[model samples]
Target: MRHLFFALAPDAALRDAIANDAARLHLAWGGRATKPAKLHMTLRFLQGFTDPLPDDVVAAARAAGDAIASVPFAFELDRADRFGRRIGWLGCAVTPRPLQALHDALTESCRAHAVPMREEERFVPHVTILRDPKRAVPSAIAPLRWQVDGFVLMASAEGAYEVLGRWALRA
Candidate 1:
């Protein structure tokens, strides 16, 4: 049993770009930048209401991952804002259709497999780039294009993310 979710991880090049963006955003917005290795866009965060879930739940989540059939897509992150006063984030100017399709497919598949998605109602695609920022007013950044090719299942337990499975989004 492990706390798990599905995420869209950037490739090396994209990670580098995000890291650079994070550095600049942190300087302007004033929060600690998220490490380069830890930058990723979460697709679906599975909730078992606990850190470790049951094996049956894990199996269901895996089966849901097996059901994904989304194609590749491109999206751009061009804005920065705060969830509240503490968290600063970078988000796309517009939600990509293929990205939405992939998320919708994952939601449907997870629902069919009895994986509870308590947070699905408010799905916003964004990446957390800074934490505990000093000043956060909605600001615009230069657009950074991300070519998404696949997504993955991730397990996190002590504030670190670990990839458990990978699934390619194909045409």
Candidate 2:
């Protein structure tokens, strides 16, 4: 059985910057901060399964990822907000079209593979910064830039992620 999802991971330098910024936000908002190593922008979430995914499903994912006709795209994190009383997130003021396209493609691939996904009312792309927040503290953040080059398939175990596959974004 494996729990899997697809995400775009930031490089070490950018991860550091996001960690530092998240730390500052935690200081002000009083929440459980996200661990630096666990930070990633989720593209699509596939729930757990009790058996190995078929080879065709994995191949579909790989081919879908490879077919993303995009160069690297940049995004800016500009605000912090809460999903409720518990989860805190960094919001982007601007999301590139390529990013959205990549997400849509991955989602379509998952559908094609017969992978079941949760029904989310809306898709708001953001990185989680904290959990179990004390209160709602929406704060303006300095615009932080991220250059996304590729996305990866990751398996989850005991609150950590193991990378299963990676596909670069190229046109």
How many residue pairs clash in each candidate at the backbone level? 0, 0
lDDT of 1 by residue, 40-76 (tens): 8888888744655567877888899999887788889
Off by over 4 Å in 1: 48-53
Q: Give the whole-model CA lDDT for all candidates, comma-separated.
A: 0.82, 0.78
What is the TM-score of candidate 2? 0.87
TM-score per prediction, in order, is 0.91, 0.87
Per residue, candidate 2 scores C-alpha lDDT tens digits across 99-144 of 7787887787777667666566656788898998786578778878
TM-score (C-alpha, index-matched) for candidate 1: 0.91
Query: Judged by TM-score, which candidate is best?
Result: 1
> Which runs in model 2 stand beyond 4 Å of their true positions?
50-60
